[model samples]
Target: MLQMGIIGYGYWGPNLVRNFNVAAGSQVSMVCDMNKQSLSKAKKAYPQVRFTSDVNELINDPEVNAVAIATPVFTHHELAKKALLAGKSVFVEKPFTHTVEEAEELIELAEKKKLKIMVDHTFLYTGAVRKIKQLIDDNVLGSIYYFDSVRVNLGLFQHDVNVVWDLAPHDIAIMDYLINDKPQAVVATGSGHFDRGLEDIAYLTFYYPNNIIAHINVNWLSPVKVRTTLIGGQKKMLVWNDLEPDEIIKVYDKGVKVTTTEGKYNLLVNYRSGDMWAPRIQATEALRLIAEEFVHYVEEGGKVVNDGAAGLKVVKMLVASSKSLKNKGEMIYL
Candidate 1:
């Protein structure tokens, strides 16, 4: 069994403990947090697991074989480096680190140590996303034309990172996973309403090779919450609404075709409209699968889709977006 030590018993820590403790190849051995009240709450729920206020105690524990970092983005590099140096695998939260350099350093160190690093891109494991991946791979959505996403909600503004760092990661990671082509450049624009210097709303556009484009809009000041994505293709189109209870994915058999006429400058346009169908999605919790995959890969050396390299790609896009945001929506090459 792979013994697990979790850092940061704040918002996301308890969920990690619950999933890893019950995972097939892992068990939660200890949890570390700076907040005494958090430790007190965790103690009641997990009496068998050890609790500590000092983070080093958990990283240095001989019984722990891996560490799951549920802390903030700024602290990821330090905590993950300590665990990797101590010869333990690491599972990090999304937006991997505050900067691309930090992510690269941790990835190189983990590679040198032969330790596994899995980023918590929980959405990738969801049934909806998995199904969508299948559709794209099977040529159901032939030759993707564009990817557009909108994720917005009011009032959950973060203190450390802006809305792009906080909300755009999920959509960006999803777009990165679905599209095989790498983006050539990116443009972003946003503004901050508060004194924290963190933008509350942002718009990002990524230019991909072969005419594929991706646009993402994220906000923390919307009147209503929306999680929706549209993928347009030559043969068909898809709509994914994450908030839907039963039907999360709807594939439409629709397309537009252009043909040349007899005249030199004449042209014809044809729009084909057909039926729409919703694929059946498995109801398994994505977090549970993520926990299981981390443990299995650490124990058996299996391949993981959301590995350190995947995290780095998402970070690279984020870095480009930040640069563009600072220069008033200037295009930054990747």
Candidate 2:
């Protein structure tokens, strides 16, 4: 069995521990957190595992073949470096690190050490997203036009990161995976209500080649949680709503077409609207699928769908968006 060590037991810790504990061919050998109460809870819940306050203990443990880090954005680089230097594989949560430089260095280190690294972009493993990919591959969505997403929720505000950094990673990762074009520039705007430094509400726009653009809206001040996105194509459209109980993904056969008259040389547009269809999505947990893939990669060495480069792509976009926000929504090239 592959032994695993988990660090940071605050918000997303329990989920990580539970998934790793049940994942086949893997065992949670140790968990590390600065909080004694968190460690106490882990001990009570998972008496089979060990707990420690010193992160170095978990990194140096010979039995722990891998480390899954769910720490803050700033501490990711140092902790991941320590684990990788100890000759253990590393799995880090989203927004891999604060800067692209840190992410690039981690990628290089993992490459030199021949150690596996998986970024927990859990949504990519979801059944709905998988179906979207399948439809895109089959040209069911047809030629893509634009991508738009709005992910807003109230009061889970992070002290260290802004709303964009906290929430945009999800949308950015999904866009990175689903879109055929890479973003060339970023323009963003945000406002800070409680804290003067951190932004609580933000809007980001991406510019890609061939006029294929994308937009993201993230806010922590919203009274209600809203997770929805729409992808428009020439032939069909995809409406994905996370709040829907069943049939979260709806495919719409509606769009506009333009034809030029020969004699008049004028552009005539035709708008078409048809029935909305919802495709079947197997009810599978995204985290479970990601856990299975992590095990498979460790055993078989297959390239993961959410690999290092993919993480880098999302991080790069975040960095650019932050810069744009600082400059008052100025378009920043990537």
Candidate 3:
């Protein structure tokens, strides 16, 4: 069994601990957190696991073969780098690192150490996303035309990062997975209502090759929570409503056909609309899947779906988007 050490017991930490503890071939050997209250709560819940206040203790623990980091974005690089250099595999939370340079360095370090680095891109492991990937791979959607998403909610505003950094990572990671084409450029616009100078609401647009395009709208000021994505393709279209309890994904056999008439000036347009079907998606916790994958990567050498390379791609998009946001929606190349 692979012994695991976890850092941070706040927010997403508990979920990671629970999943890794239950995952096959893995066990939570130790947990570290600076907050005494968090440590006390963790100790109470998991009596078998060791708890410590100093991060170095957990990183250097002889029993720990890997370190899972659930701290804020800024701390990811240092923590992961130290864990990797300590001869332990690293699993870090989403938005891998604050910048692309940091992610690149960690990736290089992990490679040199012959260790695995799994990025906690939980959404990519979701059943819905998995099904979508299958459909796309099967050519059921034909050629993708556009990807649009809206993720917004009230409160839960982060002090360390803006709405784009807080919310856009999910969609950006999803886009990077579903669409194979690389983004050529990005443009973003947003504003901050408070004095923090961080944008609470943002709009981001990405241009890809083959005339493909994607747009993401994220906000922390919305009155109601909304999680929706629309993917349009030449053969069919899809709508995913994450808020729905059932039938979250709907695929429509709909498209438009254009033909040129005998005369160059004349044109014919036709709209084809057909049935809409919802495929059943397996109900499984994404974090659990991620934890299992981490174990598999550690025990058996294989490529993980959301590895350091994938995380680096997402971080590059985040960095480019931030630059565009600062430049008043000026387009920035990736």
Q: What is the lDDT of residue 80 in candidate 3?
A: 96
What TM-score would every model get versus the actual structure?
0.98, 0.98, 0.98
lDDT to native, each model: 0.95, 0.90, 0.94
**Model 1 agreement with the true structure over 176-280: per-residue lDDT tens digits:** 999998999999999999888889999999999999999999999999999999999998999999999988999999999999889857888899999999999
For residues 49-94, write the lDDT of model 2, one tens digit per residue: 9999999999999999999999998999999999989998888899
lDDT of 3 by residue, 1-334 (tens): 9999999999999999999999988999999999999999999999999999999999999999999999999999999999999999999999999999999999999889899999999999999999999989998989999999999999698989999988999999999999988999999999999899999999999999999999999999999999999999999999999998999999999999889978867889899899999999999999988999999998897987799999999999999999999999999999
Span of ten consecutive residues with least summed lDDT in model 2: 258-267
Clashing pairs in 1: none
- How does model 2 score by TM-score? 0.98
Candidate 1 total steric clashes: 0
Candidates' RMSD to native: 1.0, 1.2, 0.9
